[model samples]
Target: MSTATNANELKITRVYDAPVRAVWEAWTDPAQVAQWWGPRGFTITTHSKDLRPGGHWSYTMHGPDGTDYENKTLYYEVEECARLVYDHGGNDDRPPLFRVTVLFSESDGKTTMDMTMTLPSPEAAAETAKFIKKAGGNGTWDRLAEYIDKTQSGRESFFITRSFRAPIDVLFAMWTEPGHFSQWLAPAGFTMEFHDADIRPGGSTFYSMTNGQLTMYGRAEYQEIEKPSRIVYTQQFCDEQGNVSRHPLAPVWPETMRTEVLFTSEGPNETRVTVRWEPCGEVKPEEIEVFKQARGGMTQGWTGSFDKLEAKIAGSQE
Candidate 1:
């Protein structure tokens, strides 16, 4: 992801496994868009769509709690699968909140989507960003990834992203260095301790986390480590002696999960972290279903961990 140079703009970028044409179709087709457009738990009803310059799209987003949000988008530019420029978040009662520019590019059979949302002012942009986070708007892109994955390969995965105001190297170290990692990797109310620490390609670690009442052990085997950019590992629950085991509380959980973490420099002193998680080796259908059903819980847990990570970064700077 690239940082927005304009203070009034918010930028986001994501790469999908699908090709450019497939991704373009997913975004342009009303039926496909409806499958993964809004935040999780929310659905939309498209009253009309006119995909051309000077045309408009009208839709109503239905909230999980029965509330409905009407939206109107006016298109200014449309370049087949290359780019789109439009005004978003407007309705009959008010003007548009921001202008959106989206660019699509492909390399090595993967499609990269870059989006910029420009608000009226920097304050408005900041406020909107906060509101989006609180409303789980980021999940919309994650859902898109899931949709593409299911369409292309009959597989399921989980995705999450967060941006922190810290240097890329510092953020990367927090993930690779055992001390810094243990300080913030555990969920809220739990403390982590690394019994065996080795973080590198082909290396592994055994750790335990406890919330005073109960303790759980886990192991991670690192498969790849690209300095300050990417890390791939496989994680599994285990006993105190490091013997592989099923989740203590959720037996239906997959035994092993492959996690890929990508770190991108958004600015001189900021980094955006994106995580992709999927079942590793053989996985049963029941386990996959359980994983799909527990996405909400997974989001909450990861959010709590990120909060702690932010605090730790702040403390380090101070």
Candidate 2:
């Protein structure tokens, strides 16, 4: 999935590995929607859901910090399994913040969801985009993807997306070029150095990251590298000598994890990157549980890296 923003609208497009009917049911069915309706660490209570033109769906979003936000959506148009148009972010006290139009289509047994939130002005749209990022609102879609993946394929994974103000090719180079990758791919306050980097299909990279006190070594074995579009790799904690090992602090972490990164061009100068992570080879139940439980930390780590990446890109532009 990818997200983009125009002058007065926020656009998001995602492809789900499920049939159109299944995707529609997962979205329209209140029972399934409640499971992944809010951002990470948030839940929702659907008070009343009437999925029809002129009907209303009311709910309360419960934040992680015990904050409850009331929301109401009035449907203007609803075509079963095809499209939806609704006014969202309204309650008894206020009017809707924006109008949303979502279109769903299926091809090759997979469903594509395209959604646009139309705001009143470009400034309003920009502000909303900032608010969504600050609140991790985008995680809601990732959660939806996870829900569908689990239900349809019995697979569990972690997902995150970020839109960068850089061309798709530039962003792709930032990942594949070791010199650029090491500049911002480390956790906050840490530095990364690659011993040997072969970032191509069937190749691998060995790198170490440190923050003065402790250093961690890892290896990424590239499985697929489609220029300017996608990259698939298997990552594992390893010794300085390049031998696979378990994380020193997280002994129960999965021995190997598969990472898939998709880069989509939002515009000529903007790109959206979506990353999915899951246990790669045979893994035990405990490892999977640890992976699931570490989502919050994973989010934080990736966010920190992204912050640095953003700064680096800004510096380059200047």
Candidate 3:
């Protein structure tokens, strides 16, 4: 944990769209770093990368202006998914231009990264800042985000099944009828405010779900409807008027998702519900990845809501 004496060092912080481990791998993995290590309009070709304490990494950054900057890095410390300390500069005999330290942290399943560049003298810091700002250090981080998403997206679907004490008819009504839906469709701590709801084939529903002071709008267009059996729909974020909107917290989230809920009669007094969720048409690869990354949170939300549904059904039966 060495500190820089110069007062003019450069420090930048960003919260990445991916988890901390993904961010750490992007820095240490040569293949991943080659995809997004340099500024915008620049490409990196790695000659060799030894990612360990006392190891060296050599690469050439090819700028769009046809200038090739030969770079080399000497790793000083490597703490897995936590910290990386290295000396990065041109391949020369003089003192390294700067000592770079990167710290990775995660909160609420997202990654926050901090990068500090320390130069030996204020004069050197001033000179380096111009090149860094012009070369687009910020763009480098932005590219890293795209790389992470591109690498993470896959053909993964979210699936969840729950058993309830109510009959199949009751469970089916809860999903297809707005009256029953308005009673137990939302998760704990959230209430639904319907702007419009028509739960039949080719019909749509729009609503705003509010939790305390926060409210989020959602819309669903029914694709398939089989009474007492299943319901298929395309769901998206929407405004009060039902216009499509981006997710409040995630910008790259898929604009539309295909949701299928199947109801089965387990017995005379029992029902089974299975939900299959996947991204829908024309979605960006990165956006699909974002959906996949959020599977955990989605599962939690569904679990909470299903628990409420189970309780509501029990009360009615009693």
Candidate 4:
């Protein structure tokens, strides 16, 4: 059997809101580098950044529990404002595998970035380097996604649907009221603390969450709010700047996303809610893969949210 053909290959693409120059700064600047680099529970500490060809970018990551991990990479090709190629890996020799390419283009004063990563051949002893990229790539992509949601973005529209047991009024209240929203907006184990929720067209929902050690901001804009029946909005991840962002979990997830929640009363006290999602396909392959998740995922998320809202409202009524 041939060795090359048997190799495991992975391909992912994420478009950034910033130009290649800005991305290069985020990828190189020590302070900006540490701000959003590494995984959710990890933080980065940079030792040096040399962006030109043959130069190196070195840093260490501090995990939630105080574990330190070193990372070092050398840039191979640096075509400013156009492309960058590099070889990166952990401190030790895990074959130091994989090559990354980033390209940037400008149209109508907005920048587009495309990143492609290729791993070492199947023959490499430590062929799992790409899998070890959770430290920075995912989170880094997330920050770029933040920049995209408020600007030009991409991908097709997808839907996430589930039913709610409460009446249309009750379900709608959870979304329109800031206090009501704080109780059920985030995933389990995370608590949302709202700053304010403006519930009309052109209004916004601003909030934050403390997921153990990770403090993150979330935002949504209300477009067409048709009381207790329908609501349209755009949602995104962000930092202190309130710029649109991405999911902290997956990088390829869309940035600027269109969300629609429709409520149809099935009975006196039951409401059927249908949620649809459409990624603003500004990026290439990333937006194309936005709706590829298992159908069961939306069910679980909406179900959990419904359960939480039911309890919150039930307690209020009592």
Q: Candidate 1 lDDT (Cα, whole model)?
A: 0.92
- Tens-place lDDT digits, model 1, residues 69-137: 999999999998899999999988999999999999999989989999999998999999989989999
Q: Residue 110: error of model 1 in Å?
A: 1.8
* Stretches > 4 Å off in candidate 4: 1-160, 294-296
Name model 1 segments beyond 4 Å from true.
none
For each candidate, what is the lDDT?
0.92, 0.91, 0.78, 0.64
- Which 10-residue span in candidate 2 carries the lowest summed lDDT? 1-10
lDDT of 2 by residue, 94-173 (tens): 99999999999999999989999999998998899889888888888888888998999898898888888899999999
Task: Look at candidate 4 and tell me the lDDT of residue 237.
Answer: 78
* Each prediction's number of clashing residue pairs: 0, 0, 0, 11
Residue range 186-259, candidate 4, lDDT tens digits: 76777888776787999987788877977788788888999888999987878767776776766676676778
- TM-score, predicted candidate 4 vs. hidden true structure: 0.47
lDDT of 3 at 296: 52
Q: Return the clash pairs for model 1, or none.
A: none
Candidate that would win on lDDT? 1
lDDT of 3: 0.78
List ranges where model 3 is wrong by over 4 Å. 1-154
